[model samples]
Target: MSPELNAPGISEEDKARLTQSGIELSMQNRCGSYLQMNQDVLHAECQEEGIEVLSYRKAMEKYDWLKEYEWKAVPKDKDEITQYVASQTDPKGYVIIAHKGTKNILPIQACLYLGRETIQHVHNIIIAEEGAELHIISGCTSGGHVGQGAAHYGVSEFYIKKNAKISFTMIHTWTENIEVFPRSASIVEENGVFLSNYVCMQPVKKIQMYPTATLKGENSVARFSSIIIASPSSYLDIGSRAILEGKGASAELVTRAITKGGTIISRGQIIGKTAGTKGHLECKGLILKDGTIYAIPEIDGRVVGTELSHEAAVGKLAQEEIEYLMSRGLSEDEATATIIRGFLDVKIAGLPEALQKQIDATIDVAEKAGF
Candidate 1:
């Protein structure tokens, strides 16, 4: 176990909460880690040779060139959430940089813990230099004692250089009283690849986010996948967008949403702006108990040679499917859970096995709860 995990302030209950959010406190099989409690950065370190992990403020002070990348992908004046995070004179977040040609067999872990702050805000930047490969797992949660009406605002920007690749997986476990707003964007250079996966099965008061990516170099690629469940008191509005601007560039956006007496709005968009570029968007939703699941998918092709397509479906589980499972000696609840599990199972191509297992474990929790 890392000494930081056993640090004085973190309690057993808090550790359990972090674990549910996909945080590995032991630091086993992790190449780097960053932890922030409320608005304070508790720890940030890198174990790999060619990677750099530091607090946002420390990164800015260490590298002057970092200023050019800050807010370059995500505009500060784009929305109120971005403005709030941008106005913070003393920002709180972690910056991870993978140097040229570097790769980590194990993924980095980032944790954001909301404790007592009414509003916790952060600005994060990630950069993958040419020929580098970076993988990160981010866990966001709240302390057991956090009160209602707490909110979190975050802004993240990613830069993938030529021939580089970056995979980021994020898991959220917040209390039903907390609200979250995240503004994020990314830019992919020539031959670069970017993969983003998000999972949030826990209850939250309200959450809204729409992340965008721009593929700017020839043969660049971007893929985004999200799995979410909205509980009775939760209201989730999530979406993702991709713009293919380079010749031969491609993008894919996929989402799986489930509502258990809550409200969920799943959105996706893809724009093909260059010749030979291609894009696709897909969204599938399921309503369990009189909840709302709304899906919005959009695809735009600007040029004659560009191609774009979208598909969205929102409905309940098929009774015949559930009955078919029950005939195999399973109970009604078990059959329903099995079908829901299969519905939420979306195998993402090119994702690391370790990250895939982490995502599976998150969904397994919801399945065990009979979702």
Candidate 2:
């Protein structure tokens, strides 16, 4: 376990930094030098837990993390972005799954590092064998605050085999000026389950992204969840997609948008392409001050043998509900906070225990400020 793992209230990002520092300390004390990128390096520390570490330069070759892979894949190399992407073509972020001859019960962990303030673009490819289970956590943040135009684009793709289980959690809270485009996808096989959670707590100016997970196997399942808070002058366009292509496949999405003087565009979709698939999309928005909040939700089914459901709701705090709370002698802010908490209680309940508590605290703060 990394040092930050034991620290209370520390974020997934801080834990990643500690893990990176620990790896460096181990290499220097045991191997005599810090690990460097762009060099083809592989290690077999343990057969049960296969581990690999690829430097930022090595992860950019196949996966362009600095720019939107499918959304904005053309080219924008003004600030050494192109050079950084070129460096990682040799060996993308290291890969370690079970050997063909052996099967393991432990999930492999990958620790990615951003040792500089320059814009980083990283691409990663992970494959889990039949019946394998892996929990991969990717962390992105700058080592220090540099000048403007310092950004990072991270794109990853995963392939989970039949009966495999994979849980990927990406937490981002970088400098206020940095821009990030994080794109990811997973293809699941029969009886496989994939869970993806995208949590944004930072206040950024401009962001555009919509990560997706497609369930293409029978009895496969996928869940897409997000938590977003928009402040004054900030703009964010974020959403998720779940597509079911086989019988007995299922998908569900839930999103929450909190806006105040800023604009947020949320688009969620559930598409069923074949018979016997089940899918649903739910979008709920909270307009604190009503700068501008647009909620566009779509559910499309091309086959008649499937069940697809979708819902879009936009509104302010309920007047009657607020009045009822205020009648108990609480102030207006307190009443608004009470209603907002009740609105988001169920959503927070489903989050990971650690993250749920953090979100609850944030909601408490938001309520005090008339959120």
In candidate 1, the residue pairs with backbone N, CA or C atoms under 3 Å apart (3 or more residues apart, or in different chains) clash, namely: none
lDDT values, one for every candidate? 0.91, 0.59
Q: How many residue pairs clash in each candidate at the backbone level?
A: 0, 7
- The lowest-lDDT stretch of 10 consecutive residues in candidate 1 is 1-10
As a TM-score, model 2 comes out at 0.71
lDDT of 1 at 306: 92
Regions of model 2 farther than 4 Å from truth: 1-117, 142-147, 346-371
Candidate 2 lDDT (Cα, 0 to 1) = 0.59
Question: lDDT tens string, model 1, 270-332?
Answer: 998899999989999888888999898888888899989888888888999988989999999
